[model samples]
Target: MSSFKREFTKLYNDSPANYIKAKRLEKAAELLQASDNRITDIALDCGFNDLANFTKSFRDKYNVTPSNYRLKSR
Candidate 1:
């Protein structure tokens, strides 16, 4: 697992967990912009099991809450 992590980090410049989280968040953002789904549904669809964690993660990445981000995109 460590070897795989090292190789992944070397190739992607980020940890596997971080990479996956980033991809998930990116997908969530795309969904937010392209669909009218509720934020909670989007969060779950993006693999986040808890809404608060999803909100914090999304805010950390985008510098805005999911609802705010969606509003801005519109």
Candidate 2:
């Protein structure tokens, strides 16, 4: 597992966990823009089990909350 993590980080410049989190947030952003789903539901759909954590991660990545992002995107 450590070897795989090293290889993935070396190739992608980010750890596997970071990569997965980014992908999930990316998908959540897409869903926020494209769907009428509620924020909690979207978070769950994007593999975020906890809404608060998801919101924090999303905010950290985008510098805006999910609802704000959706509003701006639309």
Candidate 3:
């Protein structure tokens, strides 16, 4: 498992879990821009189970809250 982690990180330039989270956030961003889904629903659909955690992760990646991101994209 550790060897796989090392290899994954070396190849992707990011840890496995962090890379997955980044991909999820990218999907969430796409949904925010392309759909009228509620923020909570978007978060859950992207594999974020907790709203607060989702908000924080989204902010960390995009430098904006989900609500603010939706607002800005409109």
Candidate 4:
């Protein structure tokens, strides 16, 4: 596994919910920087099971939707 993947997995195992949120946001950040993948695709790839839950968690953590976060960065 990659160093990042291992570190993230460790973080995930140490605190599932916290790491879930963190990993999602990290991948969301990467997607924002790297690609134009849709929010739903990024959410699923980042381990979110549902768009609604992803949106809610993202909003709770970042205070914005994934799209809006990306836009703000741009």
User: How high is the lDDT of residue 29 in model 3?
Assistant: 98
Error of 1 at 58 (Å): 0.5
Candidate 3 pairs with clashing backbones: none
Off by over 4 Å in 2: none
Lowest summed lDDT window (length 10), candidate 4 = 11-20
Off by over 4 Å in 3: none
Consecutive 10-residue window with the lowest summed lDDT within model 1: 1-10
TM-score of each: 0.96, 0.96, 0.94, 0.70
Over 1-74, each residue of candidate 1 has an lDDT whose tens digit, in order, gives 69999999999999999999999999999999999999999999999999999999999999999999999999
Q: How much lDDT does candidate 1 score?
A: 0.98
Q: What is the per-residue lDDT of model 2 for residues 11-63, given as tens digits with 9 covering 90 to 100? A: 99999999999999999999999999999999999999999999999999999
Q: Root-mean-square deviation of each candidate, in angstroms?
A: 0.8, 0.9, 0.9, 6.2
For model 1, the stretches where C-alpha displacement exceeds 4 angstroms are: none
**Candidate 3 least-lDDT 10 residues:** 65-74
lDDT: which candidate is best?
1
Ranking by lDDT: 1, 2, 3, 4
Superior by lDDT: candidate 1 or candidate 3: 1
Which runs of model 4 end up more than 4 angstroms from their true locations?
Answer: 1-14
lDDT of 1 at 21: 100
Error of 2 at 64 (Å): 0.3
